[model samples]
Target: MTRFQSKVALVTGGRSGIGRAIAKRLREEGARVITAQRGQDTEFECIGVDFNEPEAADDAIATVMQLAGRLDVLVNNAGMMQEQLAEEMSLVDWTRNLTVNLTTPFALIKASLPHLRQTQGRIVNIGSTEGLGSNPKHAAYCASKAGLHGLTRAIAIDHSHEGIRCNAVAPGWIDTDLNIDFIESMPDPKAFKQGLGKIHPVGRTGTPEEVANLVAWLASEESGFVTGQVWTVDGGRMAKLSLPG
Candidate 1:
């Protein structure tokens, strides 16, 4: 699907995990992809910037414009999670969560808007199902992601008239390296894994590629009519009611 042929995309944190998958998918669909990540990226041109210093997003956009000349797609994929209850979580940690997940994307979108206006480009934000529901020790994460979804809609409504569409993908339980590591750290990894799969209607957890596929569609002209929405790719987990054990 050469939907993105001749297009250029910038994916934040594209060096690994879900971001890596999104970049790979865009490249496969014929988009010239650049990544902004903390470490050097050998697979594609990378703009090294830590989201903690969100001012870097502006520089990243500048670097992309200088090198790629035009940006057609902006995938705000880099995010962080600090597992602490709201009571125990310090103000600093909570602020960091908002900074990395919500504020940085806002900065990236703001930086890319002018270029996206030129190309009538698209923005795909990586949100989480937790934005729609609660999770233990995820007070900050849920709030940040919910804010991101709101930002996504606000951008779509304000800028779609300018030919740039904005949308968000709220994914659940994707088996990225970080998740795998978490699962492995469990005392009974196999048992925990089995229970994790059972929570989803698909009888298994999701993969980064699956999330990337939806992102690809949203980022392309194929979904020209779809914007200001949060699409959940959760294998039906949210739709099902859990029975108490």
Candidate 2:
């Protein structure tokens, strides 16, 4: 319920999809939430901080402290995904992908560590099932997410002694607007959508709200014993073996 009555959370890219769901859920549970994104958002207390500039993370945290007075939860949800084959991907493209997905989160976490130490806060990183397995044309994306998972564990091991907890949520095929639109753009839209669901044992894709639930729990005090773990919330897709069609 009001476990976060006096707590403050910073959720990057909280303007849409999974990020929006996370921010909303945390706010619903009584946390004063600030969202950071590349563009301005009127719904939440938003700060425009592009992950492209990792230095922006420091400024963002300073802004959060000025606005909220303290930080209790840091949600590194902002990221990018570009599907380019390894051989075709330019060095610039490869670097940008890693910068947004991995480097920025690292920067943000580093900037927040001192404040988090003061409050004994938690960090929830938004990773992907790609971190656990490979996807076509996702060389950089997969590598970035895998690195993020590793970063999560390292942070937990290094900071748990300081009363900080770190964890990551690896989601697969969440029903976000971007995903729905891509599915709808297919020649056989209905068939394409069905294909997406069939990959999972649950017979459907996941929802942003489903992911938010896990993230909220991880960031809560109730998960005090939980740290250095990557929780997969992928509708059993990661566990089921696909049969030959």
Clashing pairs in 1: none
Write down the lDDT of every candidate, Cα atoms only. 0.95, 0.95
lDDT of 2 at 184: 88
lDDT of 2 at 217: 94
User: Cα-based RMSD of the predictions, in order?
Assistant: 0.9, 0.8
Measured with C-alpha atoms, the lDDT of residue 71 in candidate 1 is 96
lDDT of 2 by residue, 1-245 (tens): 88789899999999999999999999999999999998898889999987787579899999999998899999999999999889999999999999999998999999999999999999999999999998899999999999999999999999999999999999999999999999888999999988888888899999999999999999998999999999999999999988999
Quote the positional error of residue 151 for candidate 1 in Å. 0.3
Query: How high a TM-score does candidate 2 get?
Result: 0.98
